[model samples]
Target: MTQPDRDPGLQPERTRLAWRRTTLSATVAAILAAKTALHGGASAAGLVACAACCVLWLGFLLVAHRRIRDLAVPGRPTALAPRWATGAVLCTVAIALCAAALVV
Candidate 1:
């Protein structure tokens, strides 16, 4: 089979997949953090941290959406998204801390 010529343009599917992965990570992190904070012997300080993480998680999604939209226009130049996967990562860290503070 002959291969088709590929443009250097951004792959839309790749962008969608990246977004899906980010969203899923955020959701999983949120669920885990909330659960651990609520049931895993979370301290007042730990709970506050978890809440902050949840906020970060939401922020990540918003940033990701904005980035995707910006990248959608082929000829439009835009600033790159921040390197930090803030929300999902923050949530994960918060859950880990909560689990440690409470369970471990």
Candidate 2:
């Protein structure tokens, strides 16, 4: 009886790249939201929504950056914690909602 060797392959690299892409998307969304808020009449509520978008972007960035860093380390990376995952999801959804608020 013999155990098969595990093939790490490029999965980790792919995951890291995916996270980078997501981070980029979040950055773009935040930037667009700010631009809209500034040029689209700058209402008090719009400004507040823009600020919230920035905060949510930063939060998501922190979560993504930590995951990317973990993926870069050799050996098996630890599973993402439930809290971090939840935070990332919430931040993303909230960012979209805030952006939509600015638009409407």
Candidate 3:
């Protein structure tokens, strides 16, 4: 038995674009977090939160970049692994929390 040809259509392209948009959003969030942290007198806690935000942003970027690269491959891309998905979600949530902390 043989598998039938699958029409990839624009799905891969769309997914890749979505990831790019997400990366851009994350970048903006990180910048805002830093700005908020600095707008107030740079307290030790604020600086620490800012640093955490940057680290989380980097983590997300790594995950998004890998997924985008995988989508660009010629053949059918593999499904996202559970571990990577979890990591991405955790990073996103952590970034949001850090940003909120900086604002508050």
Collision count of model 1: 1
Q: On a 0 to 100 scale, what is the lDDT of residue 102 in model 1?
A: 49
Ranked by TM-score, the better of candidates 1 and 3 is 3
Candidate 1 — which pairs collide?
Answer: 57-87
**Tens digit of per-residue lDDT, candidate 3, span 2-102:** 43444447688888899999999999988988888878599899889889988999999999999999988866888989998898899989988887676
TM-score of 3: 0.85
lDDT of 1: 0.65
* Greater-lDDT candidate between 2 and 3: 3
Best by TM-score: 3
- Indicate which candidate wins on lDDT: 3
Candidates' TM-scores?
Answer: 0.58, 0.82, 0.85
Evaluate all candidate structures by whole-model CA lDDT and list the values in order.
Answer: 0.65, 0.84, 0.86
Worst 10 residues of 2 by lDDT: 1-10
Q: What total of clashing residue pairs does each candidate reach?
A: 1, 0, 0
Which residue pairs collide, candidate 2?
none
Residue 7 error for model 1, in Å?
5.3
Across 1-104, the per-residue lDDT of candidate 1 in tens digits comes to 53344335546647656877978877787677677667757778768867865776677677677767766665544556445455545645755665576455
Tens-digit lDDT track of model 2 for 1-104: 53333334767788889999989998998898889878857779878887888888999999998999998887676787899889999998897788777667
